[model samples]
Target: MSTLTKQDTFQSLLDSASSSFAPIRTQAKETYLTQGLPALKEEEYKFTSIAKKLESKIQEFKSALPFAVSKEDIESVLFEGFDGDVLVFSNGKYLPELSTSPEGITVSSLSQAENTPLGSIAKPEKDAFSALNLASFSDGLFISVPKKQKVEKPILLISFNQANSGQVIQPRVWIEAGDFSEVTFIDHSISQTEDPYFVNKVVEIKGGLNSHVNYYRLQNESKNAIEVSNIHTDIFQDSRFTSVNLSLSGDMVRNNLTLNLLGSNSEGNMYGVYLLNGKTHVDNHTNVDHTIPHAESNELYKGILADQSRGVFNGKIFVRQDAQKTNAFQQNNNILLSEDAIVNTKPQLEIWADDVKCSHGCTVGQLDEEALFYLKARGIDKNTATGLLLYAFAGEVLEKIEEESFRSYAISLIQERLGSKF
Candidate 1:
C-alpha cells in the first residue's frame, strides 16, 4: 500500500512469468543482476551508452507494461503492399488477432511452447540486454519450420511501438529451422509514439543442416526513438545464412549481429545500408566465426550520412585453427554529404587457420566530386545528380537482396529516404 521497492517490483515481475521457463528466467535474472547494465568503459558499448539511457527511464519503462492498444494504432505501422504473413507486436505484446502464418511454418506463443529452445544460441550470460529480455519478456512468439519444407512466402515480423512516450519495450523472438528447410524472415520496427522511447530487443535463430535462411531487418523508428537490437544466429553444416540490415531513421540505434558457423560447408553473408541525417546516430556491429573447415563468409555495409548525422560500423571475422579452407571477407564504405556528418569504421580479422582466405577493410570519405560534376555537366540538375551519385554508392548493398518483392520495397525505402535529404 505504501511503495513498491525496485527489488520488490522486480521479484513480482519474475514471479508472474510463465513457470515453464522459470529456470531460464532465474538464470537470466541472475545474469542481469550480476553483470548489471553495460557501462561506457566497456569496449563493446563505448560508443553507445544504452545502459545509462535505459537506467534513466527505468520507471517510465515499468509503467509501459499493460500499455493500451487500439486497432487503428497497430495498423499504422504495417509495411505498404506487403501482405504475406505478418506477426504483429504492439509494445512487445503479440497480437494473435492481427497476425497470420503460412502453411509450412508453425507459430505459437512462447510461454506455452513445450521443450522450447529459448536461450540456446544467445545465452543470457553473454550480453546484458539479452539477459534483461530473457528475464522480463512477459510474452513473445516461437516459430518453427519443418524439415525438408520450403516456405514460398517470407514471414514478416512487425514490431510496432505506440504511446507510452518515455516507455521501454523488450521484444524477444526465437526461430528454429529443421534440417533441409528453406525460409526467409523479415523484421520491421516502427514507432508511432511522440516522445523518446527505448526498445531492447533480441532475436535468436538456429539453423538446421543444409538449411537456407535469409533474414532482413529494417529499422525506421520515429525521430526520438532509441533502440538496441541483438540478432544472434547459429548456422549448421552445409547451411547458408544471409542477413541484410537497413538502418534508416532513429534518434540513436545500435545493432549487434553475430553469426556462428559451427559446421562444415556453411556460408554466411551480411549486407547493410544506413542512410542518416539530422542528429540521428546509428551503429552496426557484426561478428562472424568460422569454426569448421570448408566454410565461407562475406560481408559488406555502406552508409550515406548528411547534415550532422553520425554512423559507426565495426565488423569482426574470426577463423579458428580447425577452420581450414575458410573463406571470409568483410568491408564497410561510407559517404558524407556535409562537413558535420561523421563516420567511424573498423574492419578486423583474426585468423588461426593456415589454409584460410580472409581479408577485411573499411573506407570513409565524402562523395566523389568528379562523379557529381560529371552528371551535373550533362543536363541533370545539381540535386538530381548528387542523389544519383549517392544512390550508386549505396545501391550495391541493396542489389544483394535476392527476393524480388522485398528488394523492390527496400529500394523504394532508400529512394524515399534520400529524396528528403537531396
Candidate 2:
C-alpha cells in the first residue's frame, strides 16, 4: 500500500467514471484536470479547503453496490403523521421496492426521462463539483408536476448512504414544476455507518410561470462522513420559490445554493441553520441572481458553533443592468459558543442596476451575556437558561418552516443539540 497523491486520486476517479455522459463528461474531466479540486487558494473556497478533505477521503471512492438497509432504519427517520409519497435511494441507487408511487406527478429514472435537465440553470461549467456529479453519476431521480396540479401531499426524497468503510456515493435529482403547479418537496440525507465515507449530490429545480415550489433539505450525516451538495434553482415569471437547509452534524459539510430569477415579478426566499459541534465543519455558499425587472430575493442564514467546530457562510446577490426595480437583501448571523469555535461569514451584493434596492451584511458574535443572566435570575438554571436563549435566537429562522410537523422536528433537533430539557 502507498500514499496516493491528489492527481492520482482524481485520475483514478476519471478513469473509472462512465462515458455514458458523452462529450459533457469528456469536457468535465478536462476542466477538472485544469482546475482540479477546489483548493484553499481559490477565492470561492478560501475559508474551506475542500481539496484537502477530498484527498484525505480519496481512498473511499470505491465502486460497490448499495449496502443492505433494514426497514427499521427507514421507519426511524420517517416523519410522523405523514403518509405522502416517498422515494428512497441507497448509495445513490433508487430502490423501487422501498418507494411509493404517487399520483399527480410523473416520476422516472433519469435514463428513462424524456428530458435531462442539466447545464441549464445549474451550470456545470460554473462549478467543479457540479461538473464532477454530471460526469460520475450513474442514474438520477426525475419528478415532473403537471400544469395547474396541486400536489396535496408533500413529496419526500430520502438519500440514505449505506456503504462499507471507505466508499463514496453520488446522487443526482432534477425537479420540474409546470405552469401554475404547486408542490412541496423534502430532501434528506443520512448515513448508517460510523466509518469514514463520502456523499456528493446535486439537485436542479425549474419553476415555470406562476408555479410555487417549496423545498427543504436536511443533512444529518454520521460523525465520520463527508458531504458536498450543490442545489441550483430557476424561477420564472410570477413564480415563487422557497428553500431551507438544515445542517446538523458531519465531519465536513459544504452546501452551495443558487437561485436565478429569470422573469419579472418572481420571488425567491432562501434560509438555513447550521448547528455544529465537535470537530465538525460546515460551509454554506448562496447566490441569488436577479436578471429581470421587478423581481425580488431575500436570504438569511444563521449558525451556532460549539466545541472546536467551524462554520462558514458566503452569500451573494447580483442584480443585472436591466434588472431595474429589483429588491435583494442578504444577511448572515452567527454565535460562537466556545473560545475554540470559529465562523467566517461574508455577505456580498453586486448591483449594476441603479434603481435596485440591494443590501448585504454579516455579523459574528457570542451569546448575549445580559440575556443569559436575565434568564438565570428568572428561576432557570444556567444550562437551561443558556439553552432557552439559544432557542430564541434560532426561533426566527425555525418559525419560517410552514409544516408544523417538520418545524417541530427541527426544533427538537435543536433542543437535543443544546442539551436542554423541554
Instruction: State the C-alpha lDDT per candidate.
Output: 0.82, 0.83
The parts of candidate 2 lying over 4 Å away from their true place are 1-7
Please provide, for model 2 over 55-94, each residue's C-alpha lDDT reduced to its tens digit, 9 standing for 90 to 100.
Answer: 6765536644676666777888888776678888889987
Highest lDDT scorer: 2
Q: Candidate 1 vs. truth: CA RMSD?
A: 3.6
TM-scores of the models, in the order given? 0.92, 0.96
Location of the lowest summed lDDT over 10 successive residues in candidate 1: 1-10
Given candidate 1, what's the lDDT at residue 279? 87
Displacement of residue 363 (Cα, Å) in model 1 is 0.3
lDDT per residue, candidate 1, 393-420, as tens digits?
8889999887776787888778766662
**Candidate 2: minimum summed lDDT over ten consecutive residues — where?**
1-10
* Model 2 C-alpha lDDT versus the unseen true structure: 0.83
Q: TM-score of predicted model 1?
A: 0.92
